[model samples]
Target: MQTRNGDLSQQNGAESNSSSNHWQSQIAAVTRKLGSLPVQELKLRLPDWRNSLSTSENRLCDLLLAIQCSNSAADIHPKLTQARQEYEKFKFLCQTAQRVLTQNLTHYDLVSIAKISTTVSQPNTHDSAAGRSPALPVALRDRGSFDHFMQMWCIMTKHNVENMPKMGYKLLDLFQLYIQVEELGGLEKVDTEGLWHLVASKMGHVPNSQDATPISHIVKILSGAFVSVLAPFEEFYKERMRRTAAHWNICGPNVTPGTGIVPTEVHCNIANFGVVFGEVNIGLNDWMPEWSPYAKILRLTGMDLDQMQQQGWTDDLIRLITKFKPTIDAWREVLIKFLLEIWQHSQSMTGQHSLQHPCRPTIQFPTSQVPCEVASTIKGAFSIDEMQRAKLVVERLTQDILQTRQYQTCEVPEVQRLQMNYAVVDAHSLAIQFERIASLDYIVFDDQERTKTHLDQIALLKEQHQILQSGQQYYIMSLEEVVTAQQNFRTALGGIKNACVQKVKERQQQVTINFPQPDEFLIRSLLIKKS
Candidate 1:
């Protein structure tokens, strides 16, 4: 009976295998009959099909569960089995097609991420040298193969979390390669055409039908507002130059070549800057990445953005892109550190060890700037009542900023001496760090009275910062003066000590001279008296 059972099981397995093969062959035949689809069309069509398939799959799953729970369903079991087999084969084909389409879509959106080999171009021609640059990576050279990527980067929006980490590493790798190449004395560039050939080849092979975004179109639109703010036009508000002026700060006070640029030197519609650049207050719990200034250009890409968010693809790609930003930041950090290291190296060569250089980032972090601004305005308070109110506000703001980071130093009322922290090596030192002290919150009422009150508070806050800053400078100056005075005193004391020692030696010699034999003479006189 056991051997019979085994034979029966083997026969059933063979039948199931044959059924699966028949289903696949029918699906292949249907796919060949339908032919291929364009990418844009596929992008639009696939999501609908997927949603329908999901609904069907869920219903089929429920039916299968019911079938498993039923003992009296043997008569209809063969029909149910055939339907399940067909559905499985169809689902497989759909998934495989979607995967291929996604790959094709990814190929179209290749950002220019490559190895960075720096070429120094100083103002002097003699110093400028375009050395051999490092070769671009496979991801850049053969962009079709993004599977083997070092980093994936994205501008952080809610949609792109999936791809962000990979994107970040890609950019980091690119930057790392740049530093490595620069360090290795690679200055000359690789052939531009050859690098792009990989992209062209990918595009040619893909069925997207010139679906990749053209370089010329992007360049033209983005650069549409390129104009010198100095060249004033009558219809400046309507002109694209307005955007340029607002962005570049071309006409501003203290930026005068011939004469100082007036506030109205160049006119622009402030609205052109967009909501991304505008400041917005958020509740402590809210996350609003789309409003960041860093996402301004991306937001400006206009109508195409709406379509991109239609499916999960946007989220996936965006995540990929956003992930690259940190690595880009890491790249920026590398550049900054390299520049600062150059400054440090020069300082070392010039024998300025006492003037210490920053090792870790000296750039302010986990610090509040709003408080500092409030503190500054309080320094300009004109009235006594206003000044008092400002001080109270400043004191509160001081507490707010202080609470941001863990510090051993207790918050003090009086201004504390801010340290020259660049000279210090220990990260955990409790010495007074250069910190933003305080800033007043925005006025609740728009009246001059309220504005004046806020400004006065900031002015009072500013006074404390001023005191702290001035005190630090004065302490340094006083320390130098005290050191110089002590050095002078020590030199004079040393000379006086040498003279006193010489005088003591000479006086002792004089006092002891030729008196050794007097005792012997007295001894002789005593002997004569005795005889």
Candidate 2:
């Protein structure tokens, strides 16, 4: 009798050991995802094989290295393959988790919602080994763990959506990982996790069934939860964005003179948030299962459609700001992004003679650039604000030249060689001048429709541009002809020598042309005084 009892105890011990190992193996198999577990909850999951140092390896890698190295198609393919292999392992883990969860739920076809509400608590000894598959993070497999993740996600979306910049590089990193995941999974698969992430915590609203619940009924419950969870964000965005639109000039005014006209903190935040929102939408679109049970209905239902749509700049930001309604697309930081690109282009153009690619501030640029003290990503050596300022200058300069048709005058060599170097048409000499002027912080016409005396100086630049264009045309037409004209004029001596001097001086100011005062270089404030 004592020997029989010993044998039974050993059998039970062996069974428990097998169960734990099975759970671990299943967890190791799930595919990797971009969603980062909150740092606090990092240790809250089931024991993982990875060390603490290795857990955040995906986000902590040098973004610059990954991006610059991936620039070449040859390099990208292999790295992507390796990343996918890693992702496959994660996917396996995910499947294993789902299986365990499904089994755990099977008991309630034997589930416990109250316990699910608790966080990071482990399942009972028997429950942990519900499946032969690998184990999962406690949050994914255990009912209580689900609530923690759900709550964390809600808190993040709530706060971060309000302050988009706060979402920071995480959004960018998430998007990059999402793209890689999408490439592997394709757009056809349903993001079951996403659906659960959005709604599972609120399943309390759905009446529980002691008998087996249909997947459709469960889905409806989750769907209702999704609607409830999303309500506050949508409403908050609408109200907050409305104010933003009305006070755009107030929110995004230029700083005083001598300080560069880079974007303000406000503008940077809006722009950063816009980019984050876009990635969120892209991820959602890619992850939503096309073959979902309601896929056929979705085609006509107008729900779960792609959320991203970007509009370029309107002629007037202030004007449009006043007219903004509460649609999601209306909050796009079009001006800021445009300015960022234009500024980066200008900076590259000014810095280098040529380019391997367009001058652009990539999200994948160095991470060390943003320090802890600044409490800002834009406070870095190069920032979105600086790009915005660059765009302003580039646009103003480009517009002035185009409006005055200064580049056209460069075609007439005889008309311009004596003066107006700023207008050289054959090269980017004109662009260079534009950059220089923009740097000077000269206020032209402001948002209030007020024009400045910079007009006279612009006219001078225009004439210069035309003269350079003409000089180039003449150079191409024949340098010899110009030489002959000069030789004939010097020898002929009387017919038009004085006229030539007068013609050169025609656009030149009669008196010492008073230049724009240093103070005039300050950008005009766009604030409309509330009457």
Q: Number of the top candidate by TM-score?
A: 1
Scored against the true structure, residue 187 in model 2 reaches a CA lDDT of 20
- Candidate 2 per-residue lDDT, tens place, 252-341, comes to 334322121224343323223333333233233333343321121122122222221222323342233222212222222333333343
Write down the lDDT that model 1 would get: 0.33
Q: Would you estimate the TM-scores of all the predictions? A: 0.22, 0.19
* Model 1 per-residue lDDT tens digits across residues 1-531: 999999999999999999999987977776543336677676676667676677667767766877889886785577577667666755765655554453343333211111111011111111114432222222233423321221111110111223222221231122333233222332222122222222223223223447754644422321221111101111221132223233233233332222222224222112112221221111100233333322222222331434435523346454543443333333333334333433442222211222222222222222222223223323222234654674566566555544552322223222331222221111111111112211212111224443333333333333333333222222222223223333332333233334333433555544322211322322332223211
Residue-level error in angstroms, candidate 2, position 51: 26
Tell me the RMSD of model 1 versus the true structure. Answer: 32.6
TM-score of 1: 0.22
Please list the C-alpha lDDT of all candidates, in the order they appear: 0.33, 0.32
